[model samples]
Each structure stands twice: as structure tokens, then as C-alpha cells.
Target: MHDSIFIKSLFNTLYFVFIGTPFVIAFQLATALILNIEVKGINIFRTLYYLPYLVPMVASVIIWIIIFGHTGVVNQILGLVGLGPFDWIQNVHLIKPVIIAMGMWAAGSGILIFLAGLKGVPTHLYEVAKIDGAGPIKRFIHVTLPMITPTILFSVVMQSIAYFQMFTESYILNKGGPDYASTTYLVNTYNTAFRDFDFGLAMAQSWILFIIILIITLIVMRSSKSWVYYEAGNGR
Candidate 1:
């Protein structure tokens, strides 16, 4: 029973990270790119985009609960499109995706880090690429992406770590419910320690989770040699 629960929680955590990390990174990078533009009032735009990140986690989850609730604005919008009064939190299949969507809502920190990376990329590189008849897409693929590889690696590692330990959303919104669909490793550990009063078992579970994260992160670091670039050279 314990092993089964452990494996299920582990799978849940990995599924959450695998599915959510891409969207989080994509949204953050897109926002960073947009904010990097030197439009008037750009600072205000940055602040507005970052507002959700500033909200407390419990509060933010509550807000999501309201927004994705049966009568929430999301369903209302869907109704206009002739769909959904869907129970986002209650549906077993949709629960994890809803949680992932919630994670993406607070992508401000990632955006800011990526925006810094974008700023640090040498303008001359883009100019040189343009001179070689590189269009915007090619310049982005060859110049911008390679230059920002470090940032991508950083975001991947950090976001993976964060998602692996995801707790607040499961605890608050789903209560690790709807058939334990949202029960991540941390949530399982929390229940083991607090609900079951099994400190030793919980500690064992935590150590296993730590080892799992360490292994995965090391793998990502090792794999970075193929892609992650530094100012000096490729990461090797």
C-alpha cells in the first residue's frame, strides 16, 4: 500500500512538472519578450503582468477557485462560446491541468529572470545576424535562443524543482482530492506526517523525493552540455 501510494504520488508530481514546465517557460519567455520592447509605459506593463505573482499563494488559489468555479467567469466565457459550465476542480481528468494552469498564472519571477537574460544578450549579435540577411525568425533561432540558453536552463531547473514540490495548490484547491488526482509527492508527505502521524515514514518519503529531485536535476545539468550556452562557450 505504501509503495503504491509513493509511486502514484511520484507519478503525479512528474506529470505535473512535465506538462506544466513548458507552458510556464513559454508564457514567461513570451512575456519577457514583450516587456523587453521599449514601448512607452513598459514598466507599468511589467507591473501589471506581474501582479498575480505578488499575490499570496493561498489567496491566489482562492482566486483561481473562484475563477474556475462552476459559475466562474471562465465558464461564463465558455457559455458564450456555447460550452462549459464545467467543474474544473472536481473533474478527475481536468484537475491536474487546472493546477498546471494555476502555476502558469504566477510566472512573473520567470519572466523577470528571462527579461534580464534578454537584456544581457549582445545587441551586436542581432545586428550582425541581420546584416547576414537573417530575418527576425532566423535571428531569434540562431542569435536570441543561443544567447538565452543559460536562462532557459535556469528556468527549467528552478521550475522543475518548484513543481516537484508543489503543495499549496493541491492542499488548498483540490485538498488532494477527486480520487487523489492532484496529490503530489509533497502532498502525500504532508498527509503522511500530519494526517497519519507517521513521522518516520514521512521522513523516508521526503528523502526519497529529495533523491528523485537530485537525480533529475543532475540529469538536466548533464544534458545542458548539448544546449546551454554561456558567454564563454557551450556548457561542457
Candidate 2:
């Protein structure tokens, strides 16, 4: 029974981490890139983007439940466009997209970090690239990307850690419903510990999560030397 439980939990955790981490990283990086652009009203846009992150997690989950609930505001908007109401939370096919959308609501923190990295990029590099007749695309590829690789790597590590332990959204919103379509590893651990009073199993599951995260972090650090850059004066 112990081995079976451990294996089940491990598979669930791995599945959630594999699927969700990339989405979070991609969305945050894209948002960061867009916000890094020099444009008017950027401050306002930044604040608006980050507001969701400031909200209490429980409250944010509640708000999303209302928005994604069947016959909720989202469906109402769709109805206005002559589309039928869709069961976002209940539909197995849409569960991943719904979770991705919910995750995106709090992408501001990642964007902020990326913006800091963007600002830290040496202006001299961009100037040199411009002198070499590099277009915006080329400049971004050669200068912006290489310079910000460290930031991107850091964000991936952080986001992967967080996503591996995802529970609150699944708990509050779907309760791992729709035939366990949204059952994440953390949720399983939570259920085992709290609902089932399986403390031993829960602890085992938690340790598994810790080991997985540690391995992933080590992998990121190992891969960092390939792409992550540091200034010449700064000792890496």
C-alpha cells in the first residue's frame, strides 16, 4: 500500500510539474518581454498587471471561481456574442486552459523580475549592436536574449518550484473535480494529510516533492553555464 501510494503521488506530481511549469514560464516570459518595451503608460500597465498578485490567494481563487463558473461572467460575455455557455471548470478538455488562465492572473511578479533584468542590460551593448546595423530583432536576439538568460533561468527555477506545489487553485476552484482532471500532486498530498488523515503518506509525498524540486534546481544550475551570462567584473 505504501509503495502504491508513493508511486501514485509521484506520477501525479510529475505530471503537474511537467505540464504546468512550461505554461507558467512561457506566459511570464512573454508578459515580461512585452512590458519591457519602452512605451507610454507603462507604469499604469505594470500596476494593472501586478494587481492580481497582490490579492490574497484565497480571494483570487474565489474571484476566478466566479469568472469561470458555469453561467458566470465569462459565459455571459460569450452569450452576448451569440455563443453558448461553456462549462470551463467542469469540462475536462478545458481544465488545463482554465488553470493556465488562472495562473496568468498572477504573472506580474515574474514580469517585474524580468523588467529588472531588462533594465540591468548594458546600454553599451545595444549601442554596439546598432552600430553593426543590427535590426530590432537581431538586437533582441543577440543582445537582449543573451544578457537576460540568467533572469530567464532564475524565473524558470522559481516558477517550476511554485508550480510543482500547486494546490490552492485546484482545491478552491475544482476540488480536484471533473473526474480528477485537475488533481495535482499538492492537492493529493493535501487530501491525504487533511481529509484522509494519512500523515505518513502525506509526509512521504512532501519529501518526494522536495527531492523533485531539488533535482530540477540542480539541473537548471548545471545548464546555466551554457546560456546565463554575468558581467566581466562580477565574479561568477
Candidate 3:
């Protein structure tokens, strides 16, 4: 609790969780919604969306580094718009954000899960909703959203924990650099235990992280009772 560095790293970790996770979820849901419909080449589009997740994480992070690098593809495109040649790697303020952005690129796993959930939704439910005068938005809100609450809960919990333990991408990108602005909890834990040889403190720090993640997961799980739907029970 008293380790300021741990506190800072925890904040950075949660920043990634709170900020990055929702967007990733939104992307997954939106992409899944679009891909859920019957359309020619939908399978191809689904495969394309999932390909990024299948790429090795280390390799993908390296690719992202090159793309977001100072004079990399993004900056060149930005140059066309006269916007950015910004130091994405070295800028302290941008370090975590860029790392978070990297997570969004491989959201294929989430998209797949959401797609399954969407496809599993009963077609009869939509028919019933429509019979009650529910339009598209209302059908989605009253039926689709409720039907997918279980999927949403699953994604939220899993993504939160994944983002909380983030280390590799940040470490590889710039070694959590530029004043450790992107030094996530796990990354700092590694440095503290291995680099600083503060095994005791690092072990304690890790336990704290475990407890925090557990609590957060429990909270989400607890809240799901009111929202998550199960067709088998037809009740919460």
C-alpha cells in the first residue's frame, strides 16, 4: 500500500483497463454485429478480423511499434493531414495510450466470442419482439442486449484481468520507458523483483495485484446476477 511506485504502476494498469477495455469491447460487439448477418463473403471478413489475434503477440507488438513509430506509417498518414509526427514511443503522456491502442488491434478473440453469442441468440425472440412493435433499436436494446448480457459479462471480466496483468507489450514497446509512464503493475513487479532484487517487496506487490483483480472480478460477477440472462432458466 505504501509503495508509491507500485501505486503508480497500478494506476497505469487500471488506466489501460478502464480506458482500453470498453473500446475493445465496443469494437468486438460492433464488428460481431456486422459480421453476424448473412452476407456474401461474410466468412472471409470474419477470418480477416480474427487474423490479427492469431498473429504472435510479440510479432504484432513489433509491427505496431513500426506503424506508430515517429516516422512510421501513421505519422506519414498524419503528415498528409498535417497532424502528427508525435513521439508515440518516447512521450510519457502517450506511452500508455499507445500501448492500449496496441491491445485494440488484436481484439479478434473478443470479436469471436461476441459473434458466437450473437449467433446463438434465438431468432424466435426477435420475431416475438417485432410482434410487440419493437423496432431495430428497441429489439437490440430490449432483446439482443439482454440476450448477450452473459457474453458481455464474460468479456468484461476476462478483458479486465488481461489488461490488469499487462506486461509484455509495454515492456517490449519501450521497456515501459520515458519515465516509466507505461510501467504496468506486472512490469514493475518484474523489475522490482529481478532488476532491483527486491524479491520480498515484489512478492508482496504481486499478492496485492492478485487481491485487487479478484475483488474486481467478484464485483463484476456479483453484479451480473441482475443483468446476465440464461435461457435454460428463463431467469437471472
Which candidate should be chosen as best, given TM-score against the real structure?
Answer: 1
Q: Is candidate 2 or candidate 3 better by lDDT?
A: 3
Candidates sorted by TM-score, best first? 1, 3, 2
Identify the superior model by TM-score, candidate 1 or candidate 2. Answer: 1
Candidate ranking (lDDT, best to worst): 1, 3, 2
lDDT of model 3, residue 129: 88
* Total clashing pairs for each candidate: 0, 0, 0
Q: All predictions: root-mean-square deviation over Cα? A: 1.3, 2.5, 1.7
Instruction: List model 3 lDDT by residue over 1-236, tens digit each.
Output: 33777778888898988898898888789989999999999999999989999999899989988998998998999899889899989998888777777777799999999999998899999999889999999999998998899899999999999998888898889887877788899999999989999999899889999999999999989888888988887558
Instruction: Report, for every candidate in turn, its global Cα lDDT versus the true structure.
Output: 0.90, 0.81, 0.89
Q: Model 3 off-target regions past 4 Å? A: none
Error of 1 at 175 (Å): 0.5
